[model samples]
Target chain A: MARFNLGITDVRKITGALTEKGYPDFAGYALMSLKLSLEKIISNHGFKESGAMVSRIYSDDNFTDSLIDELSVETTEMFRDPSMWRLLRERIFPGIFGTGDKIKFWLPGSVSSEDLVSLIILLKESDLTTRSAIILTSLSGKSLDNIASGVFRSSKMEVSEANYTKFQGKGELSEYMVKEGGKFFWNKNLFSEVTFSLGKSHLEASATCVNCIIFRDKMIYMNLTLSNKMLDVICRSLSGGGYFIIGSGESLTHTLFDKHFSQVDQNEKIYQKIR
Target chain B: MYKAIIIGGSAGSFQVVTRILSSLHKDFPLPVLLSLHRLKHIRSGFVEALSLKSSIPVKEPGDKDHIRPGIAYLAPSNYHMLIELGSRFALSTAAPVNHSRPSIDLSFFSAAQAYREKLIGIILSGANRDGAQGLERVASLGGKTIVQDPDECQVPVMPKESLKLTGVDHILNSSQIIEFLKKINRNALD
Candidate 1:
């Protein structure tokens, strides 16, 4: 697990390897970061040769999915960014789901299931699991499966529990989870109404109107044209008066984002789709 | 050949950063990326505060904003700022590294990959060891590395830790750091 330096030649080789393997679109993205991250994965997984690694990634869908999984950011926990989570729990959630109305949620780029589980924890508190449905989707199918299976490291649970406590939840965070060996799993029974899908684009790509689109932090990879394109789709897909939350640092300057969604919570990057 | 400068600091590094930035020539032709740990909340105008003493404009770049010479870009709060080899920047909400959101290591490593020997990395005063290892990476990649001399730092922990590890190109104090940058800017003219 020694850190290695990559030259421009290595970047070109890896970018070409990825593009050659059917993901030609990733070349313009953070290819070097992905390259180095993949190198770390390759070393940890005992794939000594990157050429052989690329071949394995092409030959096995599971390997590719796992690679995608490794590349995703998993630094999430229950009620992260305490103030924002508290706002969602106190103000946003009750306002959106009062009176037991049917509500729909779409979480794009739902990385490593932490954010999804956190939201489910909030839903459980409000007693909205039965009346609400959440579409947890990512470009990689494995992320959706990970959400469905709910496998995560046991050590991570304590950190998440602390965050939940910080948010002042009604009960212990682990009360909703089932632990096995070194990992913890969420009880599927508690969130049976939630559905998992590999959503290719934003919620706009889907046929259904989403009441809340939590596309947070996913726009960081997209350029302006792509961001606006997805924003257009988000505006089209979001139900009137629905919420759209981007990353804390991610308010695109595109005029359309301003025109289509009004900033409801600037610090939290929460926007309300205009009626 | 250096096209950009990357500065990483935390805790008490702001004053040193503003000082160095303020002393740079207004027409300095290198994009400077400032990676300082910041509060995730407080969405408005950290860049504006830094720009008050700066000769050149300071901006907090959006996710895909392109880097331009003569401008200083502050890493936005709660995100990891990464360079894309070209003049453009990309950001990530990836988990914090070194217990920091704008982890100095993330940017230093990424900039090393993109700019290699053509980048200058500066580590300033901080309470934590976030930027120390990243400076090693920058130096290893042939990029020039500078650490603020520990004695003159507001908080010496960061620079002292970095000095313990790497034989960086320069170890400078606050005023010396400004003089060093001024020298680099002058060298660019020649």
Candidate 2:
């Protein structure tokens, strides 16, 4: 509990400073997440005081970018919530495969490459990779670059492997990775046709008529107002009868966009646009 | 006026929690926030089980859901539930703390910041130290803090850890805790 030492006021000061510096308005970001992430950024970057951090944020462009990069939530793991992945592999992917001229998937808010990698592996296993166009977007170029390079933390490999097993993958997850300098580098060929988009918010991300969008757990960080705004964009991006998936525990029931999508699987939080 | 009651419990604490919730009047004025360790994948059954004897509504609050009085909000499995400013619930999928995702410490810390002295935090029987630091935070924020008496606890580790952390306002058994809750509800009525 003491670990999250920053108060709500500190969170406001940090977010407010960033907003005044021409960053996206984070007033709608969940306050507790902002507080915890700010506490981490402040401590990790060795900013002795919020005043010093504010001053630095005002004067330094590179530091501001780095700060924003640090703040982009990267909580996703490969094949997270295996049951959802199983459903995607066993049902959703097969149904959508060969549907479009090129099955387009737009995965937004990927601060880490695990979710994208997982999707690519699934597509490859389903023999749909060649006919697919994947557009991955993120708030930070650094995250996009990391995804492009295929470099990931070696530490997460074990968990990813376990999730893969539970996801009922055809083969070992390690078959697709190589270890170098204590880091796991994924097969870059898998992402050869992938397009990466960097944007500050959903409105700036370029994707239209996408057949599938896997945006899990990201909305938990946003307040209702921001969520509603983002949901409008996400809902519009998907074509009629397209699939949408979110974190197992997340719900769109309270949002205005709920009416546009009907539930596909309640446990997996999978939905299909009803049009 | 007390705005909410936050309770943290883990192993061996379920029955005690059921007792407390079952005993509460349907018109209990404070929202009860419960953070309990549960199997991450088994999502549907816990809320139903708790709701079985609970006189008031028991819900697993969605992210950004409004915090209303007279309902018990159980922290959803695999997500960290928080009390954000403006009396709304916030959920996080950030890494777990003390190996629990709906982390007891995170919930208590956030609720303490959100409600301050108007909050009541209770630590119940459990097998771990997850709620100890949180109970300390509650006390630090000027909120009333209580821990189930260790001797009466099924596991005793959770309550014992709280006793080690801070000078809690009360150390009560299950029945006494229920009485304390009734008294507070009655006082709010007056």
Candidate 3:
């Protein structure tokens, strides 16, 4: 019952701004989250446009990075979900990709390379690296640059290393990255087959006949409308019976996608493109 | 109507949760969302263990699972589970808060945003201070707050932190917590 400044009018203005930029469901799905992010921006970098009207500051570089960072879900540890990774290693990899088969993996909204490290290490250990090609795409060119640089904040190294240990990943996980002052830069050589693109993302690709398409935690950041759009794009990208993985907590029961992807290992949230 | 029951804890709390849950039947009226800290890389059947201990059906929720009554949903390991706008669970692999992936504070705070005062948040025994601020947030929003009596706790740090941080409605032992829940169920029926 406390008075708050943000109301319907501010939502309309911000919604209008985002819609004008061709994004959907910001008003519905991500409104509160966006408002929370803007609140943090105001708290962090003093308010340029005060109280309920953060539309003006939405385009600022710092503000934009903060928004994407707030919305995107990329703090995955190396082998974060052990069962899912184990499933991938023990079952999904062998079941999907055969010998001499080239891997055209479509990884969209991969702002950070933690999940990529887990997947690539899987590929490397599986000896699929020689036949693999990973396409990492994101909306922000800046984040892609960070991914390309292969550097993670030094503070995160401890947790990532610990997770790698739990993953039973052999050799040194630290060997994958070199520490430069406060940041740990990943070895570019490790991702020799990975491609990073700024615009015209993997989701935009039509009929991408690929081995695996990972559209994980990206949906959690997006509004329902955008998530549906991305889901449709993912469905279009994968051929019938191709491997597709999503965030384990994500529900793909949206009626539009139900006919497209048959739930395989529902607990792991892996779905096979049935159509 | 109360939309959900949010429980958070870490080390030494599982048995307490199992004890509380065992007393509740499969027809328990509220959906229980748990954001317990767990090892990120180890594959432990923690939910399965709890399911066996309790009559209530327990499962680690997938991303965006509809919040439903009569079932207890555990936050998936390596993801910070959130309550989305439409009574759905959204998982985020965002940076670990308090060095925990399925951070208790994240669940309590995000679930508070959706359910507001129509939710119950309970903090139980644990080693870390993950859920203290979150329990405070729940109480401040007019939602009910309970913490395990730290004296009875196997590891007292978590509940002790909650008691210190917030004006919790109850500081109960495991049996008392079950009684509290049964009382709620009875009140709902009445």
Candidate 4:
């Protein structure tokens, strides 16, 4: 196990410094440390202390652009979890399609285009595309640019195939991508109906309410308080009878939202807006 | 003969399982057990998917199911499946270990206590060091320990981490893993 050795006093000092610098919670510290560690920005003092220092810096409005640039996971793929996609197609879309109202889908932490593409495919297959609009948002501007360009390494195709199969898929996983000049180009049709945006979770919630919101795998890095607050924002943005899908491994067990949403499918982590 | 073989994996695992099972002849002996880390709330039809690519019978394990040869048993979603002494399988709703339920460590640890030397433990592609400690218990009890070659693994962290923590007997790829199992079965039959 990867252990972090920090004394109580150390935790207090770090927490105090972070509060003084205005970081919302310990997650800013963890995220900052992970970024710096990956970038080899700090060493010798161990990751915990570095995390504290990063948290302190992050809370300051004057934190450097280079520092922010270090804290991103740029590699995300489409049809990442095909079972979830299939679940959305079979269980969730019919309701939205039946409404016949213009639908909006929010995909936060959409690092690359793969997830957006997956959503598009699901909507298309469900015949919900004509009535739906997608908002693909990510914390990193660079990731947004990469998605807009729609270029990716060919090697990722093999892994994507394996992931697709793991989800009990029915279609040929390869039908979604094309190989071009040693790089695999994602199906262009998927993105034609989507809009990509650059944004962060810490910012105020958007005015455009959505029928479904997906923030998968992103909250595992956040602390409880921040995660709950963010969940609140998500709940606020969701229209009544909307849906929220979290990462499969994540839970709202202790949160106020725990009973507010009914589980659509436990394994896919899809939830329906119940209350 | 060993009644069951349990395998565990995390990150970069799907390919490893594919390779291991694909190499088996249709009539290979013994039931195979597996516990893999998947998205917590999502149902992964792993058995159905893997069955399409392998000759052996594959299905998610059920409570009190008999451990039969020539079948592959997968731990179901959100549950830890263990092997009982009398060729029966047990399921538990235990809390998550190392932040994961259906944990590789929990299944291997339980199997180590129950099956002892009769168990075969295989650790495959994953990012974390979950199975390293439990594999130690498996080895100490005379159980066979096989780790996928870190070099060949799509995600080498788990295998490499195990190498650092314990003394394992074999490090091979997916194809070689099948061959090793066949050899073990052949020797046991003799």
Best by DockQ: 2
The lDDT per prediction is 0.76, 0.85, 0.73, 0.67
Give one digit per residue, the lDDT tens place, for model 3 in B74-118: 887777888877887777766677888888987887777778899
Best by lDDT: 2
Q: Where in model 4 is the C-alpha error above 4 Å? A: A1-70, A74-77, A162-180, A187-189, B1-190
True contacts kept of 4: 0.00
For residues A1-275, what per-residue lDDT tens digits would candidate 1 score against the true structure?
22555455655665576567655434544554555565557667876566676677668877776666676654555565666778888888888887567998887667667677777788888777777888876766776777788786675666677678887888988788887885777877865877777743343365268888887677765555556776777788788999988766677564357777788875677889889
Residues A21-60, model 4: lDDT tens digits: 5433444432322322232333333444546555746564
Candidate 3 structure quality by residue, lDDT tens digits, A1-275: 21122343565675566555544345544544454444444455555444333554355555544454444546665665556777787778887676556768888877787778778887887788877888887766667777888877776677777766656676678777787776778777888998887642334663387768887776776667777777777877777788788776676775367777777784586778885
- The candidate that achieves the highest TM-score relative to the unseen native structure: 2
Q: What is the lDDT of residue A157 in candidate 2?
A: 71
TM accuracy, model 4:
0.54
Residue pairs that clash (backbone atoms under 3 angstroms), model 1: none
lDDT of 2 by residue, A234-269 (tens): 888999999988886678877888888998875678
Task: Tell me the TM-score of model 3.
Answer: 0.84
DockQ values, each candidate: 0.44, 0.53, 0.39, 0.04
lDDT over C-alpha atoms for residue B73 of model 1 = 92
